[model samples]
Target: MQASGYSFKELLGFDIAVLSELFSSYTTLDATRHNELMLYFEGVNKAWNHPGFTFLYHYQQYVELDAEPYSYTRFFEHYRRKYPKEKGSMKLQHIAGEEMFVDFAGKKLQIVDKHTGEVIAVEVFVAILPCSQYTYIQACRSQKREDMISCCTAALRFYGGSPKGIVSDNLKSAVNRSSRYEADINRSFKDFARHYNCVINPTRSYAPQLFNIKTIYNI
Candidate 1:
């Protein structure tokens, strides 16, 4: 009904073509298109292409498809919304004597030589038990391979028992190569873990959120 007491069609100057949209039902895009987009996204994420690969480059492949491909903005939005840097946060269970997290503090400690009046800066290595929150700190000359291994070994000895695993960051001294899926441990560090009957599990290479020891132990 029209407010002027006349039929809406009589009052309006437009035809049914313009008003047809109001009564029309909007339809969803084809599911096949979304599935195909996800396929391309997964392939790119799996390192199928060069490190510098971009969405725009891959989107070109589907230019010939019948349906229009998603815009760059929409494509990126879906990728980021679906796939995160790391899987969403999960509850990690830390059994007693299960794992030890090790890292070097950013702040360095200094030692003074009385005779020469010289000061030496030392790296502070820290190890924490996830379950007990017990921490072991040691002063080391550097983050070199030998120093890291020595400090780790001493920390284990101090605990009086070796945990099932030792979690660490991708330090050159400890990790030969770091990746999101898998990380290779340095030969010496691998040997050290073997000797102590423990495993060396380095966190994701570039993702520091997974490597934060204090956050892991809630310290």
Candidate 2:
């Protein structure tokens, strides 16, 4: 009933800017969801007369709407996050020759051991540049620690210059624990990183969709 009662308290104790952001960014109805939700809001808009009364009624209607089956709190947080987005600048130490994303995929090829007549399935590793699409590949027994270190050094030499940075997936040999925003780079990898004056960053486990390598020079 009184703006003075709440506004003064909110102004002093709460972040008005944050509250404004929360309210403004709130998605009234997700287009990806049911169309009925949209129609409900539109109906409230046309039916209501007074500004204060309409806003209050619509606010209640929004929460109470039977169409929204899931938790609205979760919906709000979901919309708040730009989940499928690339944020921050890629410090890009190398425009011409700096950083490379190195990784191994699960796919493997069967190698026929000439000496033993044994069928050995070998995993393939690839290091690539996001900008140039240039790639290097090697076949190894598995994605082991030694194999990782060897493959990276060979790939760099194969490319003709030492790259300034290396990006990798949170594989067992590379990362101990994987995080969406950050991951732990292993000790040996850190040594390799320090030797070359390069940085090693593992991709967030949450963001597996972004991982794909293409061979630009060959294609």
Candidate 3:
């Protein structure tokens, strides 16, 4: 919307955080061939008199029937299945020790090998609880499988328990093959998934509105 010179209105109530996240995620997206994506959202917003709540519910409920990719029937069926992310809200809500978001922080920070005094630029690994914003950080090598799994394990122990889901970016260490709905998870990640009794969902290649991927790509 920002790319099209559209402004975010404060009219009609919705979760401020959710709206902000949406804006921040899609603001920089290059328009489609005819700017159809942005145009569609704008039209929907205008029709609803710019009501936030109405726009959200419309997508989750009725707006899809006419559109491609996410047509009405598909949207209804998704809701009917009661998917956690689609059911009540678009955001992931952590149920205590039920989920964790882990990622490799860009712009490697220096972590010296104390024994050798080598200035090793170690990547920062982060884990955040969706519900509390409680997070932890550590330094690692690259986004390699061994490093990532180790970092995630440390994060889980830091949080004191394993969650039912471990949200990760669609990187080599986490995703084995890409897909729109269910991608093949990496072997190491799958092992961790089994050990921790968790499911892994890799972010779509370049889709926005994904809570973590949105910020990750933005950064």
Count of clashing residue pairs in every prediction: 0, 1, 3
User: What is the C-alpha lDDT profile of model 1 across 1-219, one tens digit per residue?
Assistant: 343465666647656775454444566867788888877777757753343344565556555552768876787788887786665577778899989998887557799989999999998898989787788999999999999999998998899999999999888899888899889788999999999999999988677443453323322
What TM-score does structure 3 among the candidates reach? 0.52
lDDT rank, highest first? 1, 2, 3
User: How many clashes show up in model 1?
Assistant: 0
Root mean square deviation (Cα) for candidate 3 = 18.7
For residues 31-135, could you state the per-residue lDDT of candidate 2 as single tens digits?
655455445555654653432233334445567766554455543344335233456645444375667887775456689989999999988888877667677
Per-residue C-alpha lDDT of model 3 across residues 1-219, encoded as one tens digit per residue:
556344556423548786676556555533452245444555544564332234345665434443444555554454444323333555445677667877765456777778999988777777777777778888777888988899988988888888888878777888888888888887878988899888886767676233442222322
- lDDT against the true structure, each candidate: 0.78, 0.67, 0.65
- C-alpha positional error of residue 87 in candidate 2 after TM-score superposition, expressed in Å: 18
> If ranked by TM-score, best first, what sequence of candidates would result?
1, 2, 3
Those runs of model 3 whose alpha carbons end farther than 4 Å from true positions after fitting are: 1-94, 114-116, 208-219
Name the candidate, 1 or 2, with the larger lDDT value.
Answer: 1
Task: List per-candidate RMSD values in Å.
Answer: 14.7, 17.1, 18.7
Report the error of model 1 at residue 101, Å. 0.5
